[model samples]
Target chain A: MSVTAIRETGHLPDLSRVPLVDEVGVEERSARFQTRSIKKESKVEALRMVLSMIDLTTLEGQDTPGKVQQLCQKAIHLHDAMPGLPHVAAVCVYPTMVGVAKKALGKNNIKVASVATAFPSGMAPRQIKLEETRIAVDEGADEIDMVISRGAFLQGDYGFVFDEIAAIREACGDAHLKVILETGELGTLDRVRRASVLAMHAGADFIKTSTGKIQPAATLPVTLVMLQAIRDYFYETGRMVGMKPAGGISSAKLAIHYLVMLRETLGAAWMTPAWYRFGASSLANDVLMQLRKQATGIYQSADYFSKD
Target chain B: MAGSTSRVPVEKTYKIYIDGKFPRTESGRFFPLEDSDGEVIANICRGSRKDFRNSVVAARKAFPGWSSASAYLRGQIIYRIAEMLEGRREQFIAELHLQGLSKRRAKKEVDATIDRLIYYAGWSDKYQQVFSAVNPVSSSHFNFSVMEATGVVSVLAPNESSLLGLVSNIVPAIVGGNTCVVLASEEMPLCAVSFAEVLHAADVPGGVVNILTGYREELTGQFASHMDVNAIIYCDSDTDVAKEIEISAADNIKRVVNRTNTDWAQEKSQNPYLIKETQETKTTWHPIGS
Candidate 1:
């Protein structure tokens, strides 16, 4: 249970010593982020930045190989009509679909991120979860997104959750590891902060907000607490951790709000796709519609955009 | 009797209604509404392009649930609108009179507006039956056509009559399951805002009907060109305005209807063709025995 066993996290503190989040302050802070106005050149620049930061996810139970390939194609050649647009940061999928996504996105700069640890409901045994990560890695995934066992964490078993994440990070090898807090299940902003610290200290390269399966996923307050956790982590260890808000962000305006929050909270250092991402499926189309609206001086339609 | 100050007159500021909320124009500008004597009665919101943009967002958000709702439910909602308007007939008449209409004509306009709502209510569930067809095919197939709502529609209400014109243009679009944003007459917007209250009480969902008070010249280009809007109902006369809408609408291949020639006061104002104007004919074929 020593810090040495938790990957290379040598300068980390135990969970009991990490500061607890103030719920009211986080709520008030999250509300204030939406009030700032981003327009004209700044708005166009933010829209383009948001387009590049997207993860372009498809995690349905009925996702077929054809569907994953189609999504990968969309990730590569988004709105060819609007030239000079940026490609999405990555293509996120379930462990079983990682091979299809990786093969279809051949030679492209976009990364393939696979969700493991029995995602959404992380209730599997430790051995099986490690094997799932190994398989996703063997299938050529560039990043591995592992979910923390909320049940164990909620029962005051922080050590178990920390060990499990470390084991998965070891299995990820050269691939980047993203730990999903699934903040919707954590109940309070305090627990969200605690869980975020635990994941980062256990060697998470990125901390994602949700599995996109639960309601109230990736809310602003939840994301703010996690971003603060990332900020505090960098202040101590001097190593930056990326962030991804996965669910309920389907519109261009809301996505821009998230970018604003990211810049204000974490500063300009983490603005790149390498440090921030949106794990979404429909968000790409909305951003494209807004881009087209800016280009043609008219409203755009889903009929004209490529169907995801 | 005790000496007292005379009662202060209560004047209402008519604002644009979008997403079921009464919000002032994002531009924060207003135009005065004058009585027959040219005295300022009140200042109505001069809705800007951003207001129209917000309304389109609301209409697009409301389009799916509305288009998928049962036809029987849509008919019931429109019927409820007629009931609500009937209760507010006097208020509408008084507002029309203040805007320079004669008492008799104001009453007639309110009456006609009520009848128009009921007319569309009846057709809400029956228009598909009358207009849809089972086509004869040359192959071993069963081919049939049905009317589908054309998503979000934008309407430029007629400037001639405040109450009847706004109701006539809006009822048909909602009856056919398409959500709409109507630009109320600049000269007479009181009845239009009051009608929004009637719609609010009638169980009609928000964003299904948004009324804006503004100059058509400023908003016409946006209404016709917005990519989210599926159709534009131009109910004004100026040939230049019509040309602008037609040209802007071509950017997205949006369906633009020129209903400016029709008189809203007559019996001919309420018809199924107005409903058809915002609906698409969707056809499906099935092999008889594959």
Candidate 2:
């Protein structure tokens, strides 16, 4: 577990050098992003972009193969009645259901993302976590969303958390790796920023906000801090990273606000699904409902939409 | 300070009520409700189609819990609303008078409104038993039918008898466990917003009864067309507007209840059948011994 073998150059940035988050500034800036009015055609475009950037996810203990298959179907055909709608970026599930999701999503160009590393709570042994990542990647997961060891991270064992993320990233092989900070457990915006930098340096292709298993899973201020970290990381290393804010964002209006924040913080270069994603279970239908309202000039009903 | 010069009277802008909160209309438009002498009494929210859409969303969100609430609890809450209205009796009479009703007629309408609420409150838990039936079927099954709330309802409160009419339309729907989004009389919307405060104070849950004041010409189509609203009850005698509502309601096959030309002040207006209007008959067939 030598620290020098983690990257190609074997060089990790100074952990203490990560900038401290200005709580007041971040809150004001994030709140300001919501005030920009996107109307008509621009709104419709933003809605479609939000749809394309979604990682249609179902990560419940009661998740069956049938449920996984149904979620994949939803990813493929999001409101078939509305023509010209974009399909989602991916379908996220547990490691055990990755194979089921992969088979169902066949050739639809929608990726199958699986959570590994003892998801939600990363309290397991490092070796077993690596094994889980390998298993999901072997089962045809296009992307791996692994949780960080919050227990160790909270205990000031930055090296241990960094090593675990680097090991998991290696086990993912060609599949992209998304590091989950589960910011709700991190407790502070400063810690969230520090963890974002550590994950990006440790070889995470993406830094996600939460595992969606905690209260206050995702919020504007936390997301703003992570986006700033990514921007700074890109400026220093000349390498781009992705972002995924999962859970608690269920409205079309709120999702549009996230888009506004992304555009303002990261600029147009990071607007596509490859650079950003939303890990949500109930967000797809809401976006569809809004689109239907836009099309017919009448508000929609959940009764008409298929329940996932 | 006690002997300070005379001050200007404070005027109020009556906003719409949605989900137990009073918010100005999203459209930011207002209409002046003038007295008989053509002097402006107050500015009322000119609620738009967007407001109706938002209220429908609130009503639909409230439907599941309200529809499943105990019938006894619903009855008690309706009774509580009557009590709150009685406490505010003078304020409502003054509002009715300000809207151009004669002083005596205003007092009468306010009292009748209170009694009407009590009448509906008494019928709340009993209507299901009165409306349900145990049918004798040809098969060996115990066939029984019961009344169930018809999800979200959209109401166009009568233009005339503003206070009494608004309460009459709202009470029956909610008594049956249905949530409603109601549009108050455009010409006389003062008491409707005031009555919303009574509902708010009485512990009628947010979204159970949302009150909006606006022009019917602009909002009737939206109220009827919303797919989330299960029924639409229009109280005006405008056949053209009613026909328009009926046509828009056909999109979702929504239940349309036409109470056109009904006088709310009469005793005939208070009946158990009004509660049945926004209710659905759900018949259950249980297997029994042959």
Candidate 3:
């Protein structure tokens, strides 16, 4: 496809060069109290709810292609068994296993996501990282997860990081790119907000937290900061960016609270999976267990699902 | 001849503490530490990067015991410092007054600083319980986790609340078992030096809490980018300065905590978990069976 034609036809907005407000409050109660109240869900509705917003990349043993495929199969099985199950937004795996997950999820519409840009560490060269992104997209991956070079961002080399992200976005072609800021390692909320702005401006479809490898992974404060970044980005540029809070999120109540925060902070426009997702592996079963308890009036152990 | 017969004793000025000893400036130069009213209160030695490096070396040497000290012991040490601070309330008040705080506000700030220390001290043992947990693994081995302090934290204390803000930021970090090297508030360095004295009196160890009074922009960049410093607390505003520090911190993936202008005082709980999160959780696993 011609570059001009691609640019003209792309549904993705030109978020490159968008400015973002980087400093905000960090109080948990302050963040929670800032949101408005909405109608509470009935227990039945809660039980019937499917939290499809999960990414399985950080699952301990699931780093290998075989493990990735097994995870896909399990997700497919869960989808079939629980008719009420919400289709998980995607099965995020490494680039090498994108085809494995894609084949396993055939016709299921479950996205095959791959982590690129030398994910986790993101210490690789820019050209190699961009090539990795292109390779992931070529491997039937529907979504590409890339990491910003924390070194560059921390060095005040924002331009270098911005250009690298822009290049990766071009390599992604039609595939969605979720830029992982690894917010836990970013330190302050201000930097997190700045990185979010840089990512969105450089054409990130969604901004994610953590590579799930850092000491401090995703926290509510950091997620709240990122969400506010998205809200402000939308307000300024008239373009909405998706938010995916990945890493260290494993509880049902916390997941619900995150959703509540999203709903209240960004309003109903961002409540859908298209705009918000939880990149987690262990969170789904907890959501399910909570849903089951809400339905049956008795809490069920996590053993209802396979421990493995 | 009659005038020469009589003499009065001269008051000795306090020296700047560097690497555990009071040191005169290498340049043999001193600046008149003045009150808000421009009255000279004392003479403070102007510190240099050499002094900073010396303090960092002292802090590095003390990290093993300080960073690995039991949370309970750390709490005890912090609370003792708080108690000692409370006893020296008059001194802090005087210093605060010298730094431009009104009498009532100085008293209040001193009280709050002590309370803040106690508050964080009380959290040393409990914060890990609150924030960390065991992962319910499908494995046979027992698994549990809690937050561990990152060693050798470097701090740039808030310029506004000189003593109280410096204490508020530094105490929580040490209470959570992190040794720190703080760049004291330039405008109000007396109280910080005094607080360091209080820590010494409270047996806070030689290098557990190192305080340096110097230029922020000049000294803080070195602290933030230092390969040895594990974390940085930027208590001052100046977004550009913070951005530079944060970007520099990325060199070692050092944690950075930038305190905004929000009223942290009105907030109910000053959980030590804020400091706790800046550290890593090292989860070690071994087969349970012998």
Worst 10 residues of 3 chain A by lDDT: A4-13
Q: Write the number of the candidate with greater lDDT, choosing between 1 and 3.
A: 1
Alpha carbon lDDT of residue B229, candidate 2? 91
Residue runs of model 1 more than 4 Å from their true location after superposition: A1-7, B1-13, B136-143, B284-290
On TM-score, the leading prediction is: 2
Would you list the clashing residue pairs of candidate 3? Answer: A15-A201, A16-A201, A154-B247
Q: What is the lDDT of residue A227 in candidate 2?
A: 96
Per-residue alpha-carbon lDDT of model 3 for A70-120, expressed as tens digits?
788766665344565766778888788888888888897788888888878
How does each model score on TM-score?
A: 0.94, 0.97, 0.48
Global lDDT of model 1:
0.90
Q: How would the docking of model 1 be graded?
A: medium
Q: Every model's DockQ, to 2 decimals?
A: 0.73, 0.89, 0.01
Candidate 2: how close is chain B to the reference, as a TM-score?
0.97
By DockQ, rank the candidates, best first. 2, 1, 3
Candidate 3 local Cα displacement, residue B55, angstroms: 47
